[model samples]
Target: MTQELVAQLFGKALSNPILDRMDDAASLDIEGRIAFTVDSHVVSPIFFPGGDIGRLSMTGTINDLAMVGARPLYITAGFIIEEGFLLEELVRIVASMRDAADEAGVQVVAGDTKVVERGAADGVFITTSGVGSIPDGVRISGSNARPGDIIIVSGTIGDHGATILSKREGMDFEVELQSDCAPLGRLVEEMLAASSGIHVLRDPTRGGVAATLNEIAVSSGVDVEIEEEKIPYRGEVRAACELLGLDPLVLANEGKLVAFVAENDAAIVLETMRASRYGADAAVIGRVAEVESSRPRVYARTLLGSRRILSMPTGEQLPRIC
Candidate 1:
């Protein structure tokens, strides 16, 4: 049924030349180069403390394109509604999506709708595709990180994952926890403007910072050394992870970004990110290094003066976490 639905919905090639391939999103070659990215949200329970699937779908795709150094322009959303879904709930989701797109200064130019059998689908699943133009002379990719490049994170980690967990299990903590879901095109633009030497940009999503760093290390063929003390995390989040037997480093974050920049430009890039709305808590957490023969992999220096491997997550720490 899922396969059939996917074929029925996206099987037809898009009319636009750039959108015909049925990729994540459509890329158009206008006067400037453009990039597109799409993401689907099936977060369990749909609504969480700080965000819902609607806003998450929008922000996820927008951040994907922004990670490539593009300025978001437009977005299209498609919602699959279940047969018994509440109309009021649907309206609220749409309203949230609208508000998120508006905050990002992107338009919802087109969309589609479909209803499935009550049990065949979840309450709601939202898919959003975003289009953005890449400024001339700006280039960013996971493979661009080189030895000596510095790694910086936009803010404290684990907020989204911890928040979702708290809501899912009905656990109460002293401090409020909210999903860090947010669009980051503006922050990316500022980083680009600050320096053209920005090497790699990625938002740690599904597998969190650990997975993201592992990907970069393998892609760039370099080792990453992170100072454990430098990686920021809220006290509540850390305590929650300890209680839940989870690693904060492997927790997902929606409004966070990981950037690899030239060592010389690291200070300016950090300053630029800190100035952005989404990056006020940004910090340099690590550096790229030559792959060591003994332990040529991602590692973190612990507060105890020992090194620990920042390995890829074994499995879904939190399923339907996005």
Candidate 2:
């Protein structure tokens, strides 16, 4: 059964010579400064509105590399399947992974699979690891934000988490919601072409924009102030959050990114981001400034002209919301 399953994945899913070797460990060729990251996707339902666990596994790792201004090059997937899981579903998931990898211009170089008792595991869990090459002169990091830097977000936030919550809870809305899961490598490349002043790049995933910005503030030892009205948001997603008493800023977003760029080059960077397919809704949400207190902090200026500190999220608003 194991051999048959491996053969199926090799024939229909993975299309790489290194992976075809069926070796315990496949050799990889990496050069220059590379970014390496890994993430596990145990999202409930296995499939969601716009993506599935397989696609999530691929994009999640790819985005992680892209967050550091890296060009995603290679990835590996490890699957844990429950014994009674349907073979058809497994094939579908692997196919999604292949499509996502192709879309990101990356290769699935290796993988492994294991099966456990039906009740011991869910349908399937995917863990993905990726390696990417950072271009010369690129120095993106969370701690690179500086005073006078402009903060930009790629697009609307909270789409992914909101979609997952609605799906898992079997909630219906007038407008359907979908996960914003996607690969951002191309967007990063385009932004780099626009300006070299970009200091930080991050995908607001688990803890959303609020959490990511807070981390950047602490890491860069600077304060961040965002205008609530300036932040892009989908009306339906925001409404969904409001209905559930969830803060949209604290919700997860798989496809969106928050970038901190030098003030002088902020306009060009924002313009460049807006030109991309995934970043068509890019907006300048905030700015980095000198710490006003003994420590760095994040603040949001509401539409009513009231300012409130945007604290780091204490926990996931929707758990297993990859």
Model 2 C-alpha lDDT per residue in residues 18-56, reported as the tens digit of each score: 777778776888879999999999998688899999889
lDDT of 1 by residue, 1-322 (tens): 3435433433332133333455665554455888978888889768987888878988999999999999998777787878778766766677777678778877665567778898988898878887899999888899889999999999999999988878774555445888999999889988998998899999999889999999999888899999999998998899888777788999999999999999999999999989888999999999999998654489999999999988989888843422
lDDT of 2 at 210: 93
Q: What's the C-alpha lDDT at position 155 in model 2?
A: 96
Cα misplacement distance, residue 255 of candidate 2 (Å): 0.8
> Against the correct fold, how does model 2 do in TM-score?
0.95
Predictions in order: lDDT: 0.84, 0.89
Q: Could you tell me how far off, in angstroms, the CA of residue 275 lies in candidate 1 after the best superposition?
A: 1.3
Q: In angstroms, give how far residue 11 of model 1 lies from its true place.
A: 23
Off by over 4 Å in 2: 1-3, 170-174, 318-322
> What lDDT score goes with residue 109 in model 1?
59
- Candidate 1 TM-score, true structure as reference: 0.88
